[model samples]
Target: MQKYSERKNSAIDKTANPESGNVQPKPRRRRTAVNRGLDENGNGKRKPRRQARRSRSGGFKNTFLLTGIEILGLSVAAVCAVIMLLGYSAGRFSGTSFFGHLLPFTAGVLVLIVAAALFLLGWWKLRQWLRRYSEFLTPALSLSLALLTPWLVTHDQFTLAYGNFRTLVGGKEEAGRMTISHQVYAAYRRHDAAQLQKMVNRAQEYRQAIEDAARSFAVDAHLLHGIAATESSFIPRDSHDGGRGLFQITRVPETVIAQARKRLNVEKISLDDPRHNAFVAAATFKHYLAEMKDDLFLGLLAYNIGPANGGLRFIMQQYGATDFTTIQPYLQTLPRDYPIRVLAYSLAFRLWQQEGRLLAYEEGNNAIRIQRIGIPGLRAGL
Candidate 1:
């Protein structure tokens, strides 16, 4: 009994010793260049990596900055697009202006910049978030890309409208709308005895019928020159658009052609000859002018657009009041400025007589603003 109790007490003493489960393990020392070796598992290896690079406090600040810049640029792009569209609506369709043409180009560039910046920002935010949160990045990137489509489409429409506006503004300039011929007007302006003799000689040879027609119509000889210049450019032998001959008369209906054949004693009236066409046109206008002496402008306008559709009356009502100064603003879209152009021809004739040359542009000589210029006693404001 005494041996058994002594053994049990010795076992309890061994179990209660301080070194049983609390033994002091060796401290781990960092590797040095001279003694670095493989890890104990099998082969040497690197330590496990730490958390992601943007794991700390500063990461959110950068994201907010990127988002703000992106939104600001996008807002600027949208505003520029609106302004350009307004210019187009106001009849400033010609993109020849620096601001006009660049409107659309600017919009496109802005959109691209905004999209790229926003995409980069979203991507960066997503990458950071994905390290800790997978669900948010997928839908966020999808929505951003989808939203970019409308911006790109609007940019294209703005560009197209700008281009159309340029063409609508008459080749983009005044010069294009009414190009001038310099050489012919120059030949007309000689004012010397010898020069007169030379003009006489040329007139007799190249232009006898013109003088005869002018005499009969009581029209200024220079008016004939203006007509010829505008009608055929003095080429005499070309025709277009129901226009037959130098004066571009569309009055070659079957009855008129038959009468022309009988009167001129030609089997058929050919549009290629200047003399026949010029005489006929002068005769027609002379008759019309005599009948409508009260309103020369209306008569001329009637002859050009014709009395067919009240187009002339509509024009008169639309453009008559303020004179011709602001008439261009009312035109929707016409291939030519009909009134201004015919007046240009009239001025050409006046200048042809006064200066004896074809000037590029001549002041309208009270012709364009006929009612405005006046004699002192007869017309202070009449």
Candidate 2:
């Protein structure tokens, strides 16, 4: 029995120790401290902790993505803001090519679109606090800026822009109907104020001749002055395709000259004489005025292009039009814009006479400030 017990014990030890060259099943590994914490139901209490760690990592990634997006949206909005500000300056909108005129409007619309898009993006990507403010702030600011744009642009001495803005508001139709002279005056005022001032001063030298011509032919002295200024820049011997002398008089047939001289009751007329030139110009304007039945627009046009193609009768019979607006389109090769230039110079002369000093058309601080007054049917006329 003792021998049998020893053999059985040896067999058990061999089974326990596989290295003894006996075939035996391998022992299972002992559970680590972490695994030992699991409950008996096969569900680990620590599983929720692992899940929480994964959720935290994913949340951090989402936050970083949103931050990048918000930065991108804000950057675009900043660029749009700069564009809007430039558009509101109103410098690029006048007397330019069609593309130039369109630039401000197009830029404004584009900026508005970008601002709106940013506002929408902010709704999703911005932080909670930032998003709350961005929702209404973006659109409100954009709309307010747009509404103020025209007023801000009109505050400058940009004459064309001022007129355009006035027209837009629909209170002053006359401002929109700027004569050719107004455009030229604005150009000279902006680019060559000194030159304009010099011309006005030199006009005084011919004041006596202009006065004599006005009295002889019953023309306005300011009209003669403005015509001379517009035609020759107050230079007595200025010559052009129109002819020679201070008035830029076109040479007529000897018979026509004699007839004009008879009508004016003047003798010994010379084109070179400043007084004679002024007298002839006044007489010619008067003749055209009479020929056109006192139609001012046609008379002015005929003085430049002659009665054959101009004047009230010819324009009415040929083009079936009676008003200046209708005849303007048919004018060409006769300095159609000359009257506008002359008229504009006339206005400047009047202003100078009134103020005793020319006002510098400063860009930001201009003299033409049209008060906003609501007029019924003003916008409809446009």
Candidate 3:
């Protein structure tokens, strides 16, 4: 009985040590990764400690926040710009189909809403919180949008659009710039359908001449229109400021006029008749633009404010600056938006051409021309 009882106790002990066959010592409990932490109410209970909150990378934190804010702002601005562009686009294509009215109206309303949202965000919740966002995101967003530009430009509509975009002075030239500039288009321009239509029609009259000039200067037609509009309202009338016709070209000093007449074997040009006046004006503007090596704005300033020789000296002195963007504050009221107005007209002309408002003359084709000759050259052979 004693031997049996001893054997039973030993058997029970052997069963309890299930892994005794293995030679390794009993494994240790894996130390919990988290140290013991206080419970929710600060009581001692089984709780996990966090991993020290990633050590608070202050610089990274600030940068991330700033990036987020900048993205938000740029997104808003981009939407606003697209909306405003749609507005102008609406008024531009107003007489078309049902989609036309719907497009512009929706665009106009959306532009206002986007602009208002940006304004509110800037004024209310994100004034300072997102200040760094603009700084950080502007360049990055510009780069991202710029990547799409080449692709956008390659499309037929956007190719024509890119050609037209090259003509606007202060407006957005690409998608990135559009993000910020859409706000300006919305706030400043009213998109008057009638005025735009008239301006478009007026631009048609001199389309050939401007196109010719553009080819000559390797310049944009819309820019030429802007200059012409400011200089003479495309009326080809004389300037009250001793300037000539379409581009408001001024007479050479009487002495210079005499010399030019002798040199070119020409007579004094009349400044009253619109056509002749436009001829002289465009030629003279071409000369000035040439002299400036196509610094169009300076040439224009010379046209309006009178440049000494090529208008460089006065431009530097009066505007108190060298950059074009900085010129606005230094200018007198005689010509406001001096650059932008001309740029607008130039852009308008480009739009007309893209939209087929201008007849293609194919360089020298006479299918659409009415040339005057002593012997009726147009009917001579036929």
The TM-score measured for candidate 2 stands at 0.45
CA lDDT of every candidate: 0.48, 0.61, 0.50
Between candidates 2 and 3, the lDDT winner: 2
> Per model, how many backbone clashes are there?
10, 2, 5
Q: What does candidate 3 score on TM?
A: 0.40
Provide the clash count, candidate 3: 5
Which candidate leads the pack in TM-score?
A: 2
Candidates sorted by TM-score, best first: 2, 3, 1
TM-score preference between candidates 1 and 3, better one: 3
Cα lDDT tens digits, model 3, 47-115, are: 224433443566678777766765665565555345335534543554536676666666666767787
TM-score of each: 0.33, 0.45, 0.40
User: Quick one: ranking by lDDT, best first?
Assistant: 2, 3, 1
Model 2: worst 10 consecutive residues (lDDT sum)? 373-382
Q: Report the C-alpha displacement of residue 260, candidate 3, in angstroms.
A: 9.2
Clashes, model 1:
10
List, residue by residue over 124-155, the lDDT tens digit for candidate 1.
68657774765444445545654664564345
